[model samples]
Target: MLYILFMIGLIWLGWKLIVFAIKATWGIAKVLLYIVCFPIILIGLVLGGLIYIALPILVVAGIIALLCGE
Candidate 1:
């Protein structure tokens, strides 16, 4: 009776601890993943922005080159 209740309590405690650990591990994994991927994402964004900014200038230069027969 009492022993059974104690066993149930222990089981409940273990289950709660497992759940907490899993949640904590999942949160850490997400943060680490974001940290690892952020730089690559940032680099891609920077390159994309540079192309967006430079493409018009390049087109104008090409037009000038055509006019100059170069």
Candidate 2:
């Protein structure tokens, strides 16, 4: 019947709209992770290494100088 065909067409259109929305959201998430989150994480890691390694060495040197008192 024409009614049944109309119902089917509506369902198909609804399904396509839902799929399009999901794909759009997924694409946005991918772009944010790649462009924003990844570089921030990489910069944080590099700064963390400098703080962990160089900071302690400088502190120890300062303490030794203070104790020895030139």
Best prediction by TM-score: 2
Residue 27 of model 1 has an lDDT of 96
RMSD of each: 15.9, 15.8
lDDT of the candidates, in the order given:
0.77, 0.80
- Badly placed stretches (over 4 Å) of model 2 are 50-70
1-70, model 2: which lDDT tens digit per residue?
Answer: 9999999999999999999999999999998986798567656766887557555655675798699977
Error of 2 at 54 (Å): 16
Provide the TM-score for each candidate, comma-separated. Answer: 0.54, 0.63
- Per-residue accuracy of model 1 over 1-70 as CA lDDT, tens digit each: 9999999999999999999999999999988865776446556666888766466655675698689863
